[model samples]
Target: MAEKTLAGKTVEVTGEGYLVNKEDWSKEIAAELAKEDGIDLTEKHYEVLDYLRKEQAAGTTLTIRKVGKSGITDIKGLYQLFPGGPLKLSSKYAGIPKPASCV
Candidate 1:
């Protein structure tokens, strides 16, 4: 495990910088994480993040297509919101472990 300060709180994370304990996440931390990826979070982005966290808590198998059908955005929009990586980046910002689908 590794640690990083987010939102002035030092939280545990994985090697790739994903939060190990989702409980440690906050909107401020999410904003900071998105900043690192050059993304500026908006209400829509928060909706997507909330969706991801909910799905993760339910142990759902996360995928771009699944997120697309989430009514938040389509596949193209997900790509646009996250650029190079949709699912991976979203999961990371959502403070969940990197999904196996990534890479």
Candidate 2:
């Protein structure tokens, strides 16, 4: 485990940098995290992040296809929104665990 200062608040994180405690997550923190990745989150990005958090709390097995079917965005849009690593990056910014689907 490691600690990171996001939004000026110290939070625990996995070795890969995903938040260890979802309760510590905030919109400001998400903004900070996204900024580090060079992404400027829009309302659509928030929608996707919110969706991911909710589903993760519900213990749903997350995947790009599942997120695509979420009515938030399609596969193409998810790609455009996240670019390099869609599910991996979104889950990270969402303050959720890295999905098993991601390498």
**Which numbered prediction scores highest in TM-score against the true structure?**
2
- Model 2 lDDT per residue over 1-103, tens place: 9999989899999988899999999999999999999999999999999999999999899999999999999999999999999999999999999999899
Inter-residue clash pairs, candidate 2: none
For all predicted structures, in order, the TM-scores are 0.96, 0.97
Q: Using lDDT as the measure, which candidate wins?
A: 2
Give Cα-based local distance difference scores for all models: 0.92, 0.95
Backbone clashes for every candidate come to 0, 0
Candidate 2 TM-score, true structure as reference = 0.97
Off-target runs (Cα >4 Å) in candidate 1 are none
**Tens digit per residue, CA lDDT, model 1, 1-103:** 9889988999998888899898998999999999988999888888899999999899999999999999999999898888889999999999888999898
Error of 1 at 71 (Å): 0.7
Candidate 2 lDDT for residue 81? 99
